[model samples]
Target: MIVKKTDNGLVMDFPALPYHKIEWSPQLQALNLKQPCVIAPYWCDRLGTPSIKARQGGRRQGELLCEIKGNRVLLYGSCHLYLKGTIYLP
Candidate 1:
């Protein structure tokens, strides 16, 4: 996995997960949260992924996109990826 900033916000790109999940989707990743997140006015959703969007208030609008609805995704700006509730790295 790698931590980098996209056009608007920071994104943690995971390599282990299936590429199709995010390939050309701009939806770098999603967090496993437990709440409802209010989306800002400035946001861009994936062409077909209405559930995904690029939120504003950062380097980019989708910066919040990493957070999705905040129900299942918790995008990270200063954190790493966690798979299966476990973060394994070299």
Candidate 2:
């Protein structure tokens, strides 16, 4: 993963493949759900179901745009796994 510091927060660039899952530790998951969380997928303008449900054939790339404000964490990006949007923290 390539992490780049930005004025808002950080941008993480990582390789992603179809059906690839990004799992978080139990402790982190608990801490993250302490606040309101929202998830928004990229490429929503595209037709058909979300990428998470679609079958990806080859290696694809995506990014994670992360921003923090006070106690909230906002994440938005695109990938085969379709993990994008806002997440709250305790």
Candidate 3:
């Protein structure tokens, strides 16, 4: 996985996968949380198959939604692919 800051926000790059799941950690959740950000994935499919299994928050495409809540931030996504409840962030 590769993460880089762009003019718009942060972008994440991941190898195309047949199936994948990911979750953001506390440390990762703290990046620029106060502002609206977009985490977009690069190269997210294999022969049109989705890299991730999330239905929302763009997780199905290897992305996630980040928002500020209290002192920390929240990274939310429901990934259902290959295995249940399996998630990896970066």
Highest TM-score: which candidate? 2
lDDT scores of the candidates, listed in order = 0.33, 0.34, 0.36
RMSD, every candidate, angstroms = 13.7, 14.4, 14.2
Rank by TM-score, highest first.
2, 3, 1
The collision pairs in model 3 are: 22-88
Q: In candidate 2, how many Å is residue 1 off?
A: 4.9
On residues 4-72, what C-alpha lDDT tens digit does candidate 1 reach at each position?
456954443332222444332222332322111333211314232333333223232223333444334
Candidate 3: deviation at residue 37, Å? 16
TM for every model, in the order presented, reads 0.22, 0.28, 0.26
Candidate 2: worst-modelled 10 consecutive residues by lDDT: 48-57
Indicate the residue-level lDDT of 26 in model 3.
23
| Model 2 Cα lDDT, one tens digit per residue, 1-90 | 343455854333333232335454322332244311232133212222132221112233323443344445554444333367899999
Q: Residue 39's C-alpha lDDT in candidate 1?
A: 33
Model 2 TM-score relative to the real fold: 0.28
Q: Alpha carbon lDDT of residue 62, candidate 2?
A: 29
